[model samples]
Target: MSQKNSEGKRSARERLQEQRRKEESRTKRKRTLIAAVVVVAVLGAGAGIAALVAGGGSDKKKTAGPLVAPQGATGKDTVTIPVGKPDAKSTLTVYEDFRCPGCGQFELGFRDTIRDLEAKGQLKTDYHLVTLIDGNLRGSGSLNAANAAACAQDAGKFAAYHDLLFKNQPQETDDAFGKKSRLIELSGQVPGLDTPAFRKCVEDGTHDSWVKKSHEAFSKSAYHATPTVLLNGKDVYGDQKNPLTPDKLRQMVTANAKG
Candidate 1:
């Protein structure tokens, strides 16, 4: 072969090798871009799920609706559901939302003791119904449930209905009490609470406004969590930043009786 032809062949080989290197570099860049996009998509999805769990779906505030105070309600917003007796020496105030799992735990844990104390006329409980979870969870279950409870109060079965509500509480993510019919059905578990008046009240959402007002009051208060309990106007769980055990609750009430 002539020297010029040989040199031309060598140059062609070099060009081919350079072309392959450039193609490989392009392929690598493309793969890197695709991997980066996948990572971003996964991160975005995770963020969305976290927002949902945190109840950040919408900007609209969660409210119980119009502000109509129930007949027997007391306190600034008339959202206070009274149990025990007016003249009871010790007052046990509770700030709670029906949709809150923590509140359910507290109720189930202390139901019997609370009833016993109330029965003995040693303790009176003021239940403040709030709708924070409804706001966070984006539903009307908390509001509806609170209204149904108020209706139960009107029917003279608040205590029974309260217990029943906590007993049948659904998962934190589920809006179980959003339907009025479901609330009425739940009332059946509480004797004498499934009357016509109670049914009408639940259906009409008579206490929705009251619940909203209660939630407003709750937001204004120093509390930032549900299942907040105060014994004789003092926080029962203040000493320990955790839930009060049955024994601790009994001890607190017993001490309150002495003072």
Candidate 2:
């Protein structure tokens, strides 16, 4: 009997040891799984942070438009014009807010002469667009208008389409046409355009980001007020820099050509 009791005690001890071993194994597995999850999470967070920083830096460098290799630029500089001719010695850049009344007046004053110059390839014009007001007229409509204008450029109707948009601009009221739809209609007014292609591209949000970047570039640059114009990368101001009439513009060009 003493031997049997001793045997039974030994068996009980072995069983207990087995259970403890099993418990320890389970604990180790749980710890391993938890450690693996934590490592994955940490790695994922690091990658995300790196991506955000990289994207932000790239955006600041671009300031506007997508990444473009420096092209048609003078020595030690880069020129970015998405739709215009690749090389132009003379450029006319405009900064304007869609809802600014002053800009509308400037457009009325200069559109005809600018058109003639553009056709003659004597000038390449760049538009830096902004939305001074939108919600009061139509919620975010001005922003949409600017974006659509950029799309028009992509569709090869920038100059004519630009005229159409400003010419048909609506007042601040309930009767105002919403921006996106209005742009579709305005596409038809652009001369020598494939309206269907333009309409489709605008609907797809093409050049929207470019428009935003152009606006940001203007804000970052030395330009002030709507219709701020530049000739050959030099700011044009006053009757001396920018002539008031076509004849004056022609004269200035002729004088510059002679020099």
Candidate 3:
């Protein structure tokens, strides 16, 4: 009850409060440090996952078998399948994927016009097959169909088989074309195209490497979509604002044709 005793008691209470405040501050700092470490660890783990995914894709590409150009294939890397007379004045370069709906539409719309131009010796077409849809949709239909089309090229029935395949293209999600039997069955529709050689080519994927090579070329090129059509090295398709139609294609080829 004396003044000095009261002062001592107040001094003790103040010291205890200060000690509690310091302890709380230390605990908060420790929790903040733990949280920062967890964030860094999570970020590092995410980066490692991303690297593995990227490396797996690269490894798969590197494992593609030896390049085997299809029979009679021409152009750089022997990836082009020439459909019209080599002496034709106008050249049409086409990049297409079998499972691409846009390519099917292009072929269905221009098949007759292209054939007519070829018959009249006015235009030559260099077809470059790709497998974009297979990569996008995680299926083998595009690759399988491209290989079979290359097989048809070997039998000199490429144009016919090409048209037929586009006409019979399944839904993008459907991998019907991946079956060699389906390709062979379709080949029966083309005269002299279902021989043992053609069958073996389809079943053995003889042209798969060639198709993959062509696709790799396309992937590296400036174009990123299917049905990339060029006229005399000029981009005539892929411009939605100025779409190319069968009539326009015919007129352009006719205008460029030589006597």
Best by TM-score: 3
Worst 10 residues of 1 by lDDT: 56-65
lDDT of 2: 0.60
**Sorted on lDDT, highest at the top, how do the candidates line up?**
3, 1, 2
lDDT per residue, candidate 3, 108-183, as tens digits?
8889999999999999999999999977876678888998999898888999999999999999988888777888
Error of 2 at 92 (Å): 1.4
The alpha-carbon deviation from the true structure for residue 87 of candidate 1, after best TM-score superposition, in angstroms, is: 1.7
Worst 10 residues of 2 by lDDT: 69-78
User: What lDDT would candidate 1 get against the real structure?
Assistant: 0.83
What is the descending TM-score order?
Answer: 3, 1, 2
Pull out the clashing pairs in model 1.
66-209
What is the per-residue lDDT of model 1 for residues 1-259, given as tens digits with 9 covering 90 to 100? 9999999999999999999999999999999999999999999999987776567323233333566676677876577889998887888999888889989988888899999989988889999998888788687788888989988888888889888889999999888787778899988888777889888888777777777778888898899799898988888754566757878777877787787
The reply for model 2, stretches above 4 Å from the true place, is 1-88, 135-138, 172-177, 191-196, 238-246
lDDT (CA) per prediction: 0.83, 0.60, 0.87
Which one is best on lDDT?
3
Error at 178, model 1, angstroms: 0.7
Collision count of model 1: 1
